[model samples]
Target: MNRPSIARPRRPRNHPDRFLECQRAVEDTVVSAIGEASAAGWQKDEIIAAMIAVADDMQLALNAKVLLSVETELGKLMKKYR
Candidate 1:
């Protein structure tokens, strides 16, 4: 049996509006994951630490400015959820 191929949406590299759309998609996914983790009894610190680890892994792909932004936002989120 052969599985059907899934078609992924192609995002335009230079489109300003597409960038916002992608950001919103990422935000939604992260929020959903956090909620699921919380429901699964993960502590707030654990969740935040997991996110930090993910960010650390992403360092190779992210610029310094973006990494700083992510860290700053994670700090804010950690405080908000505490």
Candidate 2:
């Protein structure tokens, strides 16, 4: 399966500060998600599945459109979560 690429603005290739900033942002988001899920009484498997589903959806979103397989997977995931 081909992964879709997002059209993002070019960043400086050698910029450690920018790279660290982006890494920190992703880490913070993930930490926040874990805390919220735990507070909401989610089990480990539920949280892991949710994270996987969201990561897959994010890829579709970044591509600015969803392919057929992506759409099907998203629907299945939503139904499972719901």
Candidate 3:
């Protein structure tokens, strides 16, 4: 009789640092877009400010519960690669 293979379970896919990296990439894109929009005079000041504010919040205002979940999962993934 063959014993069952007990592979270690994978961690959750949502990573906190990954989220932060996404935030950075988004912010960069937003900056480029905002600059182009400003030059083209196609964007409103209030709209631009609102979008930037939302990005900043996502980058910095991460909820503690969610952050813990993400960071723990990331730790597992990192361990897997090592």
All candidates: TM-score: 0.46, 0.46, 0.37
* Each model's total of backbone clashes: 0, 0, 0
The TM-score, computed over Cα atoms with residue i paired to residue i, of candidate 3 is 0.37
Best by lDDT: 1
- How much is 29 displaced in model 3, in angstroms? 1.3
In terms of lDDT, the poorest run of 10 residues in model 2 is: 1-10
**Backbone clashes in model 3:** 0
lDDT of 1 by residue, 10-65 (tens): 67778767766666666756667777788899987899799989988788567777
Which ranges in model 2 have alpha carbons more than 4 Å from their true place?
A: 1-21, 64-82
Which candidate, 2 or 3, would have the higher lDDT against the true structure? 2
Weakest ten-residue segment in model 3 by summed lDDT: 1-10
Cand. 1 TM to true fold: 0.46
Lowest-sum lDDT 10-residue window in model 1: 1-10
CA lDDT of 51 in candidate 1?
95
For residue 28, what is the lDDT in candidate 2? 56
Candidate 3 runs further than 4 Å off = 1-12, 42-44, 49-82
